[model samples]
Target: MSNADTILVTGGLGYIGSHVVLELMEEGHSVVVFDNGSNASRDVIDSVSRLAAGKGRVDLFEGDITEPAQMDKVFQEYSAISTVIHCAGLKSVAESEREPDLYRAVNVTGTSHLLSAMERAGVKHFIFSSSATVYGNSAILPMLETAPLSPQSQYGKNKVEIEKNLHAWQKKNGGIVVVLRYFNPIGAHKSGLLGDRPKKEAANLLPAILETVSGKRPELTIYGGYNTPDGTGIRDYIHVVDLARGHLQALKYEPDNDGVYIFNLGLGKGYSTQQVVDAFIQETGLTIKQRRGQRREGDVDACYADNTRALQQLNWKPEYQLNDMLSHAWLSHKSSLM
Candidate 1:
């Protein structure tokens, strides 16, 4: 009953989490998925099963990290789950604003509950699903991991709070914890078996574009009148598959010299809203009807990443280009219709 090979992934059926689960299974690790079915379902299980090719072990436990009792029961049941890639928690910045308390309760408090369970269970390795929003509004073009911390939204603030708490906990806890601060994650699995077609209304850009093209929405609304080249916000969009591989690399990292390490997971390239639209049209040959809208609160003008650390430390780099991202994304979206 070695704990080293058993991994527990929260929110394992979400967009990014599902891909990571596939990678984990591909790498022959036993995975236990704990999700509340808030934003996911067993639908992804079918995809993972196919992607796994019966090479890895997997199980499911319907639980919430915020509920101590549920979390405790899960830990007791899957005592072999020593390493965790925690992907559960509310993700949308806009949703967080509409419900700040919900953000705090789930993102911050829920993480605390998970930490307690980890300590009690004596789990050693932890990989947190963090966002680039933790960088907030920095004037720096390619933000580094050491940039000043000034989170704008409740979602970003909640991540900062959780990071600070993890710092404190890492002092007493003797294990490796990798906090992956992700940039925009778009696209789908190359196989088109798993993709992000959320049950909720569109909150992300690529999904909005897909929905607009698919006629789910009348049109796509581009946010903000920014002072960028195209008067729209600039973001670093890493293909979801590339981002998924980062987690696998993080899990494989030795981290022998440090207790906690932070890495920015991105493609290290910035693309504006207009640029993305043009690229999408070029890649998919589909027109996205767009209307300009006022800038959403808590969003920065330009935010990319300095991915040097990830490449040097984890031997990870973006292998997919923007074209590859768009093509795969469109294919996945089309496959969903079949």
Candidate 2:
């Protein structure tokens, strides 16, 4: 956390990465945002800069993580980069199922390249943006950090493989590696300037809800046939702001020694699809035309998190509840329209 050392954030222009960049800047750490610009906009750099407000400097380096030379060049150019917060990867569940090879190449191999480049550049600390999909549909009530991984989708498999790679890399190189496995992340910055604006297809539930509310989609589809009370899938939806703050906490965490520390970033509570839709309608005072749809492949009936590890270890607790998440998301969505 030295003021002189810059934190390199991969995929810094993406939804989660951009928020993490903001948190880092607000913490008085200069950031080097390295993004491919494939699924992100150059405009995010400007928005982040404005939001940072003279706290810490922000710089963007456009490069593909799959390109070893480009990664090496960025690391070489920014010799002061001491830590890398990795958020780059293809993240669509349906898309991953269709293009498993593509997902593996980018999420797995691209990360391998990034790690090699970091090793070459002598950068030690690392923080990974992992997902709850790694846990799959475990029979356990609340998914624990120690639960056996049984990924249901190629996207989840990619995360599991990446986590393995991270552990191996840390064991070999010996450095601080924090893997933050996020559950269902929703909501947006209160200012409404920065939020999830996917360049490609929208896969997440909240985005689909937003689109339905705005008439971009005809109606919301609730995947049914689950064992929950409403027979709809349940997930632990955490606010994007709180998720970003968890990254900041990870960056600030001082470990006894270098090792791979795993923590689930979630609200530790489950909310069914029907409950979410109902809450959205309640919060926004908007009508959402919706229908029941068959459950998609790789989907679990109910999956939430046992976030006690994160709460005790990182001192990170979700500040926003379901109502706050829905309302803030609605506000950001409306502001985007304006």
What's the CA error at residue 263 for candidate 2, in Å?
Answer: 0.3
Measured against the true structure, the TM-scores of the candidates, in listed sequence, are: 0.97, 0.98
How high a TM-score does candidate 1 get? Answer: 0.97
Note the Cα lDDT for every prediction shown: 0.89, 0.92
Give the Cα error of residue 175 in candidate 1, in Å.
1.0
Candidate 1 C-alpha lDDT tens digits along 84-152: 899998988999999999999999999999999999998868899999999988988698999998888
- Each candidate: RMSD to true structure? 1.3, 1.5
Worst 10 residues of 1 by lDDT: 1-10
* lDDT tens digits by residue: candidate 2, 26-52: 888889999998887888888888988
